[model samples]
Target: MSLIPVDEALARLLGDVERLRTEYVALPDALGRVLAEPVTALRTHPPFDASAMDGYAVRASDIATVPTVLTVIGESAAGRRFIGHVDDGQAVRIFTGAPMPDGADTILIQENAERAGDMITAMEVVAKGRHIRGAGLDFRQGEPLLEPGRRIDPAALALIAAADLTQVPVVRRPRVGIIATGDELVEPGRLRTDDQIVASNNFGIAGIVHEGGGEPVDFGIVPDDEFAIGETLDRAMAGGCDIVVTLGGASVGDHDLTAKVFAAKSIDLAFWKIAMRPGKPIMAGRRGDTRFLGLPGNPVSAMVCAHLFLRPLVARMLGTSTTTNIWRARLATPMAANEQRQDYVRAIARNVPDGIVVEPMSVQDSSMLKSLAMANALILRPPHAPAASKGDVCDIVVLRHIT
Candidate 1:
């Protein structure tokens, strides 16, 4: 009858979270995936000490005087090394990324040199290791280049490639199956009476699962009959879904049969009825390989709970650190006194004179989605919170990541 405490609810919801086994995947398919193993360098970067610029490799001592003259020994371009050692009064013409000649320790820019019939003369002096990328400049063979749980990006992929990795071991994407229930709910484009609501929450939840890095498969909407819900759950399990999310009928009521259905399916109950507004009726459990999440009937409640619990579950299964840290901003307007429960108030953040301030949307109803679209963040209110003045720093959950 009362709201659950946020901390206790989080602990209970997170208790069953576990990572899946790892598998080797090609680099191209590895983007956005969490690494399952530490990525160690297979070979030294800049395998051979090489130039970092188009210049002439010369001994620093040989360019001690103004307009110093040195005979060009040979040319060095990328992948074309001039293995000849440099002698006194001699330089090697080298291009960017080219391996420096053996005896040369410094480089003089071509702009600082004058070409004279197969001979280039040094004009300015340089120091040792200058304009040169020494061996292991980026990474060394046998060194840990990336740790497990690191999310792969373009830069990371490039680094892996440079490490001579044709593929990488990564956590598998969580397969999330969505089942929407409610006789009044229908799919988009379907003819519906005024009493019948469009079954949009399931699709939206599926999309949210994808945004959270899980693969979502929609099982469509089912009538409020016990057999229909059971059938959908069966289909979800047969589809090899790691998690089955049932929309609506999660609370205690005549029509709320999701929890019963999940129980009948022999799911080990995790937790239900969190101490959070808009989504207090959320339920979680597990049936063998299938995890179950029963969301509230309210649309906004489903989304908020998805962000709070479902997203983290996916991240855990994928072996990535998960937390909605969008950077806290101040509240633009004073807030009302909160009840004994955590609240995720949908609000829009605007760049006002003070700073980036979040103002709660006028419509904070559980069923409203219009206000959700206009909101940039969800401001979190601690349980039994008191009314606060403007400029109170608060935690926010962004629909998108910034950094």
Candidate 2:
């Protein structure tokens, strides 16, 4: 009904949110998914003491002195280990990842040894266990390696695989239905009258949803008609969307019918009109299990709202941390004071010698998509803050990595 602070709005949106259902997926499909359960090692890594280099495995005492000749007893390669033992003054030709032969405590790399027939001369002294990977060097069987709520990245996937886990329990990706509402908006590349503009918010919102680890279902564009918007909302709810994102028609205007349609569906409006610039008209609600977010029609406003609200919502649903990328930076130029609403000024962030310096774009109109695209950070100005001069440090939400 009334405007609320951005932090308060976010708290309401995710205060009681719970993680989605868990599903077991193969390791290959687990990337980017949050683990719903801890992953334990099924088998010990390296199973046994293995050589880490391609050379001779001998007793460290035997190679304590250089230029020592030792009789080669056997050869050990990956998967095919030498079954014999290496007695004193004896060595075993070993390859990387090969199990070290019994009685061998170190490896003399081939580069540091000269082999002639069945004998090899150690050219350099190698420490005991120098090139040998001890049993369970990485992890032991039944040891917990990955904890719950951990997102499966490339390294996590590899770790799971190395732990002998073929399948992993991960939070199911939340299904997000994205709808664009406006009669003046048309699909991209479609024929449009001078009064109509191409729809772009849905695509950007969908990308944000995906980047947040949610599956985005595009409901296409709906006209300003209440029935059309209501029908789309019904379909999204029926389709079991965990979250429904409506692009545009959030403000109370003649053509704004999204909120009306949501009301007809008995959606419990959480809060509307946050005390923030660029996205002041944003609204959030929920009906049954499907949460709804009505973002401003302006492209930049919708995107910023998505980053601030939608991203955290998805992360919460995935049982992961909802930390944002806010950082501190010094202002590169002077900035005017703000009013009651907090300002998110899109700007270019540069890595200067001292620290990160942000220069606000000259024009910060919410409707300008080009400026939003060119921005790598958003300077956060609190409500009713005083004007700031150059070099004043301020908190910023980093949109892109500062280079």
Candidate 3:
């Protein structure tokens, strides 16, 4: 089969994806989860007219003139109301958040008033309805506090709490089953032979899944045997995983049996071998309701592919809008021309006076994890593009903050 373009492959992968089921979670647990239903206020905030400052509640007509004397009736503190009316030439001493006295429409701040025993003199011309929070000032009952598809962040959580909502309906997080293949790979910090290398792709892919709001389930390592790979795929499917990702064994090598296992499990292959560097051998397919992705063995390639595909897949499953943080940046150094495949050059981005300036790393080998770790951005170069100068502007996908 021919290699698929990046855009076409991604479009096909996310075309008919449906959102997961909705579940209710506590307000505190709803952080970072996408809302499945609108959050409406349970009750009106500031159920009654309250004081916004520590002052005396008086009639607007009474404080219209400066230096007017008024008798102090009673005090209104938070959770305690005066209950009596403020007649003409009378005021009620009130603290912040206290219910306003009946017949009182204005507040005379204490800074502008002088108190002597039971009498207080207004020193300034106070405006009507000043320093008072009217009923339902924040929000009214039955009003929509947040819309569906909104991700609950810190501010959203506070707003929900203030609206008296104890729990919220949010889309369930997608469960991703990650399996690492190849006999040459061994778990980190474990004993291995001289020819074996530590397995690291699964950890990076799991991190990417978590950051994208999905729950990752590590299925451990599978050898080069076709039976082992097929059995692991069956187990993942039976475990109710929404997405199954296998690290390594995606290329056309003798030991590459992941694709064969996928075929044996009756998976409908969408496309394989994308027209992108470092991740050309990537494969995507689907078995029943579980999406399948076979990523390259190289650490950098696996991470880059996961960011490009898995992140957006999770977002689609959560019923949230998918957006990429791609920004334009000036090149700080010259770059050679590209070939038939598109290139994602790892680079460092810095904020300059004019705008963002990006400098591509000298070494961009797909197996180099150190360079990938140090990179905060990826300069996107189209297929068959010409060489670029030091000051040419290019699109960059932001990975993290430079600092």
Weakest ten-residue segment in model 3 by summed lDDT: 319-328
Q: Which stretches of candidate 3 lie over 4 Å from their true place?
A: none
Segments of candidate 2 deviating more than 4 angstroms: 64-66
Q: What is the TM-score of each candidate against the true structure?
A: 0.93, 0.97, 0.97
Error of 3 at 403 (Å): 5.4
Q: Give the per-residue lDDT digits (tens) of candidate 3, residues 324-364.
A: 67899999999999999989999999998899999999999
The clash count for each model shown is 1, 0, 0
Residue 349 CA displacement from its true place in model 3, Å = 0.9
Off by over 4 Å in 1: 1-3, 351-355, 401-403
RMSD of candidates 1 onward, in order = 2.2, 1.3, 1.2
The local distance difference test score of each candidate is 0.85, 0.93, 0.93
Clashing pairs for model 3 are none
For model 3, state the Cα shift of residue 352 in Å.
0.5
Q: Please give, for residues 70-151, the per-residue lDDT of candidate 1 as tens digits.
A: 8888999998888689999898899999998989998898899999886776767677678888998888899998998888
- Candidate ranking (lDDT, best to worst): 2, 3, 1
